[model samples]
Target: MGPTDTTHTTPLPVVLAGARGHGSWHLANIRRLQDQGVVRLAGVCELHPLDETELAAFAAEPPEQSADFGSLLDSTGARAAVICTPIQTHAELALTAAARGVHLLLEKPPAATLTDFERILTGVRDAKIACQVGFQSFGSHAVPAVRALVRTGAIGTVRGYGAAGAWVRDDAYYRRAPWAGRRRIGDTDVVDGVLTNPLAHAVATALELAGSGAAHDIASIETELFRAHDIEADDTSCVRLTTTSGLPVTAAVTLCAEQAGEPYVIVHGDRGRITFWYKQDRVLVQRAGHGPEETVHGRTDLLENLVAHLTHGTALLAPPHRTGAFMRVVEAVRNAPEPAALPSGAWHTAPALTGDGTRRVVRGIDAAVAAAADTLRLFSELGVPWALPTEVSSP
Candidate 1:
């Protein structure tokens, strides 16, 4: 079908895959957009039927629900699908949808490996359907503004880029699903770690700010992964990616934090720096001979972006091709040795923010993360006492 078939006058038919957990966010957004007459929620693919309470939210008219993705897409005649299934299932589900000539809003950490990512990329290309990878933060209006500044030399000669995110995830988080905190489940790679999953926006947005979202733009990646919790994957990690352009982008993030805070990316330059708190769509611009300029930006909804592309030839943001570099980082994490557990002296169990629970908090992760971003050093190379340097690189 073409834009003429999906004109603004006609609401695009879209289906939701995996409509529980984080998929609920898509449900709410779809319903909200549905009210505006831009799109319609045609069906849902879930392992089990949604309960009465869950079904009530779609009160406008119940959407078709089924366990089989292919059947759901065929029956609904949906033109697009949003895949928020587990990390390991992304490529499989995406290819399934693409085969049906369905566009996609695939969730972040698009696939567990670069090979899987490329497979999904090739499938979408061959199908000739739009696929918007869900790096929602890139939908922020501030992102383009920041990029324009870098392109026009508003940030001066760019030296490097860095992003920092320190957040708390309780033990219950891992138990929520079988795949949580796992690098590999059986033979399939999950790679669901702090860097690839929860704080992934930080990593992807940093690469965007550095103008290195394409896989070819990445020259090498050096990673120091560590875990403070008992999970299989790293909960706290740092990465230094040197782009083909010779610019470096560093990302330091933790699921175990002493104090939880917003995640942000910093654009470092000789003149000054630009700090973007991506979650809040906030920006801080500091340049030579100018007062600090800050603004909270509005965001473009990715779902609307997809529909606009189909209906009005609007540019698709966060497509799979733009996420190749981020996938390289995921591939590196997947192939890296099992993360080293932090020494007892380096961590402590803090009383949970809620009643009668506990969470792991690295003693000095906050400062160390800042130091790594500021100095372009990995935790081990930065001289943290309890840290031992273990670096893995990918060409």
Candidate 2:
């Protein structure tokens, strides 16, 4: 249906689930939508009771609180639901929302497993309800321009790309939450770590730039996960992939960095290159014909874009469907074996170190570096078109 046809004449009331933690971000965003008259604050569904101070913050009349999803939906008279639950419950909650004929704005890593992710997709398709995944970067202003450059061959025939980011998390950080770095939820070991969490944006961006069709035919993927900390899942990972169109893409993510630095991705072609720096909010472009360097800043208007897409079938700048490619890569990475065997050192000697350190670190930094190099070399040997040294400079 066209956007105008779907646009609610009156503000549609929205019920928000998972009011604490990340859910609070959704609450604030919904409030912004309400302030703009895009949607009305119907109610909130949280596992915990709302304190008096929190309740008083709502400008709209206080909404009913319900622990149960069905009761919550009934109590609020909400037409749509925004779910920000833990990774494990996303699919079930989304399925429940779909069954209720409620549209959805679910957080990233839509489901713990590919099967569950597909199930949610099937539910959305079967129910004919509008569902948008939360990959905020997809809504960035630079996306269209970047896509245009790639489509128009501004970068010439896109040959390859690379992305990297360094994020630090201490033991206390993982201890703060029960599900911080786990690979499995219940019997299913779903890979949801740095790759699925922080680096998801980079993966989505790569797929978007590479185009949807190419994403559908991934050539190969190699990944290494490092449990460098006291987390059940890998906090550090590196992946190399080749698209069906013969374009190479590599991404490295870490929560074990000593310090935080900018996260960046660069796409290269015969004609030129385009680089995106997430931390700096800048895009640098260089072409064969152009002199010096040109840079542009990005302003992401996700909420307004989402509202427009919902109200009027306006083309979505970033749709949840594009995430499937990223999920495939994530699955491959989680399934890949560790590049090196565990160290022979006494386990007790490294108790103070992080989980991955005993094995990935105690063996020494040189060993870690060699293992990483070997992993990448194997990817290249496997026919992944990783650029030779002369093609691009390392970050």
Candidate 3:
């Protein structure tokens, strides 16, 4: 968003698509790296151009802003692009960038459907371009550290992997975007549910810890989805998957938490268990014959990692293929019947913690989510009163 630093080696020309909303974060990050002589903010793609005031924070001189993404990339000679657009548009925009041989840092929930995921994946492969999916947790050093502890039997005989995300969102959250909390926007799938959009890192990182994060590594999936909010998507949901090696990985998440807190993934083992807070790259271990230990690990920012990959040939942290198993979960949710709306008796409205508009909170959901992860059980299996039977999928 600022002038390119050409005092040293030329910075990689980078275009940012959807330069508002979450794209704002990408814009600021580009400016940070731009100041450090890593990447230049070459162009910005937005539906409506940012006003002078809106663009004032980072853009010393406004980068080329245009609604036409492909033309902007071409005009700016972009070497890479960061896409933070709606979930449904990822494939088309990614392929457009790939068509011009631009590398990419595409945002999470790469596409609404696995078909589109494979389509874009194949195109990027055919182009031989580096495409990084924005699952930033995968960039954390703690991931490998947890695996190392497991391998060393610090947790001893991995029993299962469980992740829990309990977050709170106000009613305004769904109103912020046309596709927010939506399953499908007409025939085009949006799939903006709790597990797919907001807390997706929990699911992806859990599968990664289970060492089952590829399509072929996952054998089956079971999902129990429920909505406390009056949206077309689920705000409370849990998914359990069996790896090809017979490991169970489960994630239970909710946007209707009574009290917001950090989400965590736990490695359950026969001897003891390890807990990881992926966002913070922090881990805690309690194993047999050892007192509890806590550690804070380093993390590579995905965008910076992508830049390093292009300029220095560093390995991409979250290549599209590594997210295939998560996409499989998304595909299962897409094909499953609409999430059941919770009965009136099941949830109640409460004042938002931020004191804005109220958000629906499912009664006792915080415990339910934690229980599902701790036990690797579905909500129904936990005897939750309103939970419906899970829909299971096998490939």
Candidate 4:
């Protein structure tokens, strides 16, 4: 069939594959699309059998088939698939979907390696299908507003930026999932950790807001992985990067602190600073000579925007191509140097195990000891206060 003929005749039915954490979020987005009559929910594909809770959840607005990915696609006749699998499997799943002529909504860090990501990109291009990457913030209101300001010179000649936040994950968190802090996916030594996974969104969002893409110069990036509880990947990281335009950006992420929330980005230009809190969905613009900062709430209409773009030919706020650039930054961070070892006797002491409930207190102490040891090892092997590429320079 001809391109236009194929596009017009086929109804875009979406099958959600690998409905895990972010996959569940994608399912919600799919439901939103169905409610708005933008697309039909064909089925769900997950490796494990659905439990009673999962079955009941789906029964509310059940799909035609909820089975293995290939079976679900065959049974439901879906025209597209949204893959939210682990980082290691992204390339394979995306390539499979492309081969089947299915549109894709792939989660971020497109693949574990540059080669894998490029292969998926080539496949999607060859198939001539719509492929949307899950860099949700790109569709947020704050991104567009900041981009417009930067583009129009409202933030006169952007120079540098800074971002920091405390990311805290406890011992039990790592034990809960096998892939919690792992760099290698199965046997492949893929960089699948905080920088590539958790911090990917912020990195991409910052680049988009700054109106920059892949760095022309070798953008330097450094990372540190800590085992708060014997996990394989780094739980905390501080990264500094320079854009092709010479704008320096710094990002700090940690899963070892107990903080309420993290500050997002602070973009500095000749004119002023624009600060955004992602979790809070708030933006504050402070101009050079301005007395009071102007605040704007970021848009909560990301899913609707995605649907509108796919169904009505509307312009996407964050197209997949732009999203791909962000993934490149994620790769750079993953490739950074491992942190230096920590000195002996420079560790935080645990609280005494003296309480009325002696047994419980003792158990807690044991857990704390284990966690501390793990953290120390992580820092020693993978430096705690690690520096990014920008922090190290030639004299």
- Indicate the worst ten consecutive residues by lDDT in candidate 1: 1-10
TM-score of each: 0.97, 0.81, 0.96, 0.79
**Which parts of model 3 are misplaced by more than 4 Å?**
1-8
Per-residue lDDT value at 252 in model 2: 65
Instruction: Show model 1 residue runs off by greater than 4 Å.
Output: 1-7
lDDT value for model 2: 0.65
Give the residue spans of candidate 2 off by over 4 A. Answer: 1-9, 213-215, 292-303, 338-395
Per residue, candidate 1 scores C-alpha lDDT tens digits across 92-166 of: 999999998999999988999888898999999999999999999988999989988888888799999989999
Cα error, residue 110 of model 2, in Å, equals 0.8
**For model 2, what is the error of residue 261's alpha carbon versus the real structure, in angstroms, after optimal superposition?**
1.6
Model 3, TM vs. native: 0.96
Taking all chains together, the TM-score of candidate 4 against the true structure is 0.79
Encode model 4's per-residue lDDT on 313-342: one tens digit a residue.
Answer: 656555556655556655654554443222
